[model samples]
Target chain A: MLEIKNLKASINNKEILKGVDISIQPGELHAIMGPNGSGKSTLANVLSGKDGYEVSGELKYQGKDLINIPIDERAQKGIFLAFQYPTEIPGVNTNNFLKTSLNKIKKARGEKEMDTLSFIKMIKEKSNELGMNENMLSRQLNVGFSGGEKKKNEILQMKILNPNLAILDETDSGLDIDALKTVAKGVNSTRDKNKSFLVITHYQRLLNYIKPDFVHVLADGKIIKSGSMELAEQLEKTGYKGIN
Target chain B: MLDFKPNEKEIEKIGKFSIEEKNFRIENLKNFNSVGFPNKLVEDWKFSDLRHIVSKNFAKLDLKLKPSKEENFDFIKDFEHNYIVLVNGRLTSNSFQHEDNSQIVINPYLNKDFSNKKEKNPLINLNYALSIEGFNLEVKDNYKFNKVLVIYNLFTKDLNENILNSQNRIKIGKNSELHVFDYVINKSEKNFFNNVYEDLYLAESSVFKNISIQKNRSNGFFHKFSKNILSSKSNYSSFIFPLGLKFDKLDLEFNLEGENIECNLQAASFLNKGDHQEIKTRVNHLAPNCKSYQKVKNVIDLDSKGVYQGKIFVKNIAQKTDAYQLSKAILLDESSEFDSKPELEIYADDVKCSHGSTSGSVEKDSIYYLMTRGLSKNESVKLLINGFLSEIIVSIKSKTMKNFIEQKLLSQIYEH
Candidate 1:
């Protein structure tokens, strides 16, 4: 469903991603594992069409050239990025934000928007499954959410949007064991033959719950090796230097 | 002390009219002629230079007060209120269908002279001097008013430059409750000046809530003043939303005369495309155990400008008084500006008083996050602005009124 070739991106003319290549088929799960400063987060941001990036390479999503599209258009086309650091917007109700987001995407897709009652019911069901408090939907989004609550909320957004491909950029960091399991469950529930997930992380802990179909080791902004889920087991034993 | 002159020709002919029969009117005219207008030399009128807008030769054009039009009163028709309509500064109708054993006394005119009543402010003096008709709106003692009373001040387009002057005194008697909505509509096609004065007195154990909306189109200028006095065990709440006017200088004052009185003063103005609005407020705690709270917010874009000056005073007898004041603004453009001054004057050693003011542009992080949720840039910015002002708008007690104001705010945002 997605493909990247020789992707080189930089910020402020300082190179971050030298050359990277990855390919994912529909219904497949791919995880990028690396050490800190390996450009894992940079790749996720570049793929999501964030600003202030000098990017060059061939990136295709559903056979469309994705490099020139705007950030919101990319999101409307079902490319969701679970932010590592979510924004705290005071005076903005969480329920209203979610409803507006869903309607925006639905309008872009030429689909009928859900009414208020149905939208509330669906969000309650999804939030309940993610172990999120119903009251959180009334408070300002992420204004006072705990660390785990913020991550869980990101996953909650993922479930509510039902995107075709969701890039979880370090979705497992700073999460306790219980939160990690809940997040993994939320990610696993949305897996389907037409849906894909690119999980980027520094450690293999998240792979333990949501096993990936393929594991790629990214070193110095380039994917040096690709293997099966057992590859994560090997990386846990040996460090990045020992991977080669 | 400035060399400003009275520009309105009709104002100079006030002696020819019979309304000068009252001594107060003549004193007020003298005050207006001598004092002229407010300028930068005055401390309270520092930011708003009335002389700049009301030029020397701008006469109050002569126009006839015609009958009411349907469109002039459309915006406030849906609200649940006792309707009081004024056409060209003249009262046309006062009706109340819902009365729960309440006494509402309306005196069409005030006999006393109030020219020397307010000596410090010249614009207020001008209002009283030119005002031909006045209203004494009061609720008798121990009588609770169930319906919200709405006074609609509307204008009709005329060839002559219009100057509207009207005074109203509202009194909520002991142990009574009342809610008021003062809505001003400028349906005139050309620019005019509207100067209004309102005096409110809340008796002991009475509750009063007021919401004022000034929805004037482009090139309209208004100078408004409202004075309030709160008695023992009384509660007073006021919310002012000034959005659509080209230029506005509004002054509000509250005096806590007795113990156990509570007052809330709030003002919000959203300006765009060179629109200007200024709100000045003062709250005095004269008795012990009284409380006052004030918050003013402004949002401006393009070349608009907004100003807020708020002060809190505590007398020596007002020991154990609690007062808080805050002013905040959001400037959305480099050319847009906001000026705020929050002051506190306390003579009581045991009183608690604090004031704060802040201004800033929209947070980039906020915009990016909203855009990531599939909202366009314009949509994202609109949502942020609305959310920023929702804190003050949500405080309105009536759901319909809140919705009405919200719609007005949104339309103003998008229409530009």
Candidate 2:
């Protein structure tokens, strides 16, 4: 579902990701665990086609070159990135934005757009399953929302859009235990053979909820080790310095 | 440059006035002719070079203009209310079936008080000199209107290189209440100028709310100077949506004359396609325990220019006065321009007065976040602009009125 080889990304003439490589098949969940500023978020940003990055690497998604695609086109082509710090957009109702976004993606993919009635029904169901207050969807997008509510809103978006490849960039960082479990449950419910997830995290707590098929240790902009859940447990015990 | 200077014959054409009124007209006309149109040298006209803009746009401006045809205009079907229709700044017709006729007095404006005050704005001088038509509205004491009054100011298509000046006054008696929607609809295809002078007086314990908006884009150069006086315990609120004109300027002044008055002024505008707009306001806290607030927001597209100059003054006797002012702008492109100046003058040490102004391009992070949700760059920027302006629109308490104004605002944004 996704492939990368010798991926390097830089901004302002400073290199952040250097020769990092990762690969995942359809239905596989991959985890990239790294300490602070280890290019984990950079990888997610570069994959989602954020501008201002001087990127030179072999990055392919679904056997197509993804480097030249614009950010919205990549999103339309089934790529979703859950931001670490969700933006608080004032005066924009969450439900209205979601509807516009869903319809745009739907039109780009040659699918019928959902009307307001059905869209409301679908959103109500998805938010209810995640135990989010229905009123949150009517308020301004993430404006005055709590940290946990913002993260859960991101997961709720992931469920609504139902993208092919979802990149979770530190989605579990600020969540409490209950929120973390609900986020995990939301992710677990959407797992299927046709969808893929690249869970990027700094701690092993999130790993205990939704187990990853493979885990890679990212240190100093490079993946130094690749293993399973055991690798995350080892890192929690010894830290990044213990690996070397 | 075309001569905007008017001769005495034009004043005579208006009517036979008393000696005092005639002298007032002659003095103001002389003042207007001396300055012609205000230039960038004037402190209040620095951001707006009216002299240069007028020279570039008009070859000749006719001072005497008569409506040639009975123009048709659509009354707003969005809400039920009483309405007054004005064509080319001349009051044409009105209906007040929703109110007690005895409590309401509406008539063609005849300037009664000929008190001569030296005016600094040349446009105001011009209005006083050549003004002929408008409406004088007075509500009887303790009478509250059952429905909102809609003033439909329409400019006909026959207007070309013409200038129209009018004076309007609205007085709410003690303990009376009124709400008004000043709707302007222009059909003029060629360039014309419209100058308006409005006076509002809120009596003791009276309440007045006014919402002013433009219907669509037009080839109109507009200027309006509104002066409001508030009495004890009276409340006055104004919302202005000035959009889609070749050139527009609103000079507003409010005087809190009595104790415990509350005054609020808010505006949201979308300027595009080389449109120019300026809003200058001065609010005076003359009484104790009064509160005043001013907020103006603008979105300027390519080649458009927007300006806001707001000032708050608190007198020495006006202790415990609270005043706040803020101006925010979003420039969409390099060619777009926004200029803001906020001023506060306080002689009362116990007063609370604060002012702020900000102007910048839209946030790149906000665009990126929206794009990640499958919205294109254009769509994302549009959504952000709408969101920025909707903060003001949502303040309208009536949902139907809010939606109507929101649709008009959206059309202005999308027209670009």
State the C-alpha lDDT per candidate: 0.83, 0.93
Model 1 regions more than 4 Å off: A36-38, A217-226, A234-244, B1-23, B56-72, B75-79, B100-102, B114-118, B215-218
Clashing pairs in 2: none
lDDT of 1 at B216: 52
TM-score of chain B of each: 0.91, 0.98
| Native contacts matched by each model | 0.62, 0.85
lDDT of 2: 0.93
Model 1 agreement with the true structure over B29-127: per-residue lDDT tens digits: 677778677667779988877776566424553323333453445745676678677766667677777775348877665435533575688767766
DockQ of each candidate relative to the true complex: 0.71, 0.91
Error of 1 at B204 (Å): 1.3
Docking verdict class for candidate 1:
medium
lDDT of 2 by residue, A1-244 (tens): 9999999999999999999989999999999998888999999999999999999989999999999999999999999999999999998989999999999999999999999999999999999989999999999999999999999999999999989999999999999999999999999999999999999999999999999999999988999999999999999999999888
The lDDT leader among the candidates is 2
State each candidate's chain A TM-score: 0.98, 0.99
DockQ of candidate 1 compared with the true complex: 0.71
